[model samples]
Target: MDSVRTCVACRKRASRTELLRVVVHEGRLVADDRAVLPGRGAWVHPTARCLDRAVSRGSFPRALRVSGKPDAGPIENRLKTLMDN
Candidate 1:
């Protein structure tokens, strides 16, 4: 059976495969395309608006259970790059 995850920004529930998984790597947010990275993770829709909400609302840190704010650029760039490819 498929699992479900909620977007930390929008708080909408969806199938895990439908949302992008993100994790903090080296104190920065990065997308887990294969969802294989160890440690804490949060799911979000792969859209700039969703990403912006996640950043503006400052939910990443709480969702990832980490202290301090992490940069959101890398995650956004990764999504854009994925869309472009």
Candidate 2:
């Protein structure tokens, strides 16, 4: 069976393949498309709406169990690229 995960922004439960995995790396938020990154991960829908909501609500730090906010620029850029394709 497919694993399940909750989207940090929307707070909706969905299959792991249906969400994008995000992890903190080098003080920045990185999207793990292959879901193979080390460390704790927070899942979110790969869309601008979810990304914006998560960032605006400061969900990453809490969900990832991090202290401060990690730079979200990298993930934002990644979402943009994904949307363009």
Compared with the true structure, all predictions reach lDDT values of: 0.92, 0.97
* lDDT value, candidate 2, whole model: 0.97
For candidate 2, give the lDDT of residue 44: 99
- Alpha-carbon runs more than 4 Å astray in model 1: none
Model 1 residue 24 lDDT score: 96
lDDT of 1 by residue, 1-85 (tens): 9999999999999999989999999989999989999999999999888899999998999999999999888998898997797
Number of the predicted model whose TM-score against the real structure is largest = 2
TM-score of each: 0.93, 0.97
User: By summed lDDT, which 10 consecutive residues of candidate 1 come out lowest?
Assistant: 76-85
Which pairs in model 1 have colliding backbones?
Answer: none
Root-mean-square deviation per candidate: 1.0, 0.6
